[model samples]
Target: MTWPVVHISRSLDHDVAAVSSVAGNPANLPAWAAGLSSGIRQEDGRWITDSPMGVVEVAFTGPVELGILDHDVTVPDGSVVRNSFRVVANDQGTEAIFTLFRRDGMSEADFQSDADAVRSDLDRLAVLLDKCLLRTR
Candidate 1:
């Protein structure tokens, strides 16, 4: 499977305590994530949202439980593309990687567009972190 990745990282001027607090809070998903309006409650403890692209749901499955947000988009010819948003924290800071993929043949133009969209979304994340996650203290 071919998956294109777009990654972004920034170090907040605050300590890990503040950064971790925001990273660990699932309720703040929509605050930063583009296309995501609100996170709905589900039975399995995953946050759900009706994103700009489609209906997306995120779950924490790993030790850090980096929330996974995914939704599928359909092309006119009945092909499907999967879009995913992943958020994780490291010594540097919180990192977000968005990927786009297709099961069948997909054009390079489509892939580039998809990657650009993800990059724009991450751009919003940078603003969100500055405003909501990291505050002057």
Candidate 2:
């Protein structure tokens, strides 16, 4: 079965390198990816987080310095969800894009809700990165 894919993106004021560095780090998810987890930690070399559904493991699939933020999330049921996220140059700043998939068995309403969550997370990432840039200046 083919899953519907939606690309949710947010334009950030910081440079592409800066956005990728922060967004690609699993340790920083709690601050921006509110919809994904409340907190995250490394357990036995795996990034773990507690979600509304249950405990999940997150792993970055690519290097951050290259603007690739793709990751795989292992849910409580042992299913691994691949998430595509990338940061690209936009003028003097960056555009962070998250590719969300409408998974099997997910209703239309649930899919829309998930898309909204991704939008919110990207917005939060922009805010967080802006704060970091401000502090460095």
Candidate 3:
């Protein structure tokens, strides 16, 4: 069965290249993506972070230069959660989009909370990019 999906997005006053450069980098997760992680470190070519659940690995895939920020999160049990993320050009700026899938057995309330958190993370990312606008663009 297909899971319910929601696309969370935020528009930034920066180019797609700029957005991709910062957002696609896992090292910058603590700076903006608080919902996903507080801090991330590279170990053996893998992005490792401690989540509320436990230690997890974030492996970003696809061409980041093309604004494709797709990634997979490996949990403690070794199961992987695939995330569809991207940044697209919007006028002179860019719009970052994160696709969240409602997992099996997930509650409606919990799913909504996840969506809310994603929105907040995107907003934080936009604010961060705004601060570094001159350097990025």
Candidate with best lDDT = 3
Q: Candidate 2: where are CA atoms >4 Å away?
A: none
lDDT of 2 by residue, 12-54 (tens): 8888778877888888899999756589999999999989889
Q: Which RMSD values do the candidates have, in order?
A: 5.4, 1.2, 1.3
Model 2 clashing residue pairs (backbone) = none
Alpha carbon lDDT of each predicted model: 0.53, 0.87, 0.88
Per-residue CA lDDT of model 3 for 8-93, tens digit only, reads: 98888888888888888888888888745578888998999999989999988969989999999899999999999999999999
Worst 10 residues of 2 by lDDT: 29-38
Residue pairs that clash (backbone atoms under 3 angstroms), model 1: none
- Note the clash tally of each candidate: 0, 0, 0
Q: Stretches of candidate 1 above 4 Å error?
A: 1-24, 42-44, 51-56, 65-103
For candidate 1, write residues 1-137 as lDDT tens digits: 55444443443443344544554455765665555545545546646556555555564433334344444434334455455545555555555555555334667887677567656656665676678744554
Instruction: Evaluate residue 128 in candidate 3 and report its C-alpha lDDT on the 0 to 100 scale.
Output: 79
Q: For model 1, where is the 10-residue window of minimal lDDT?
A: 60-69
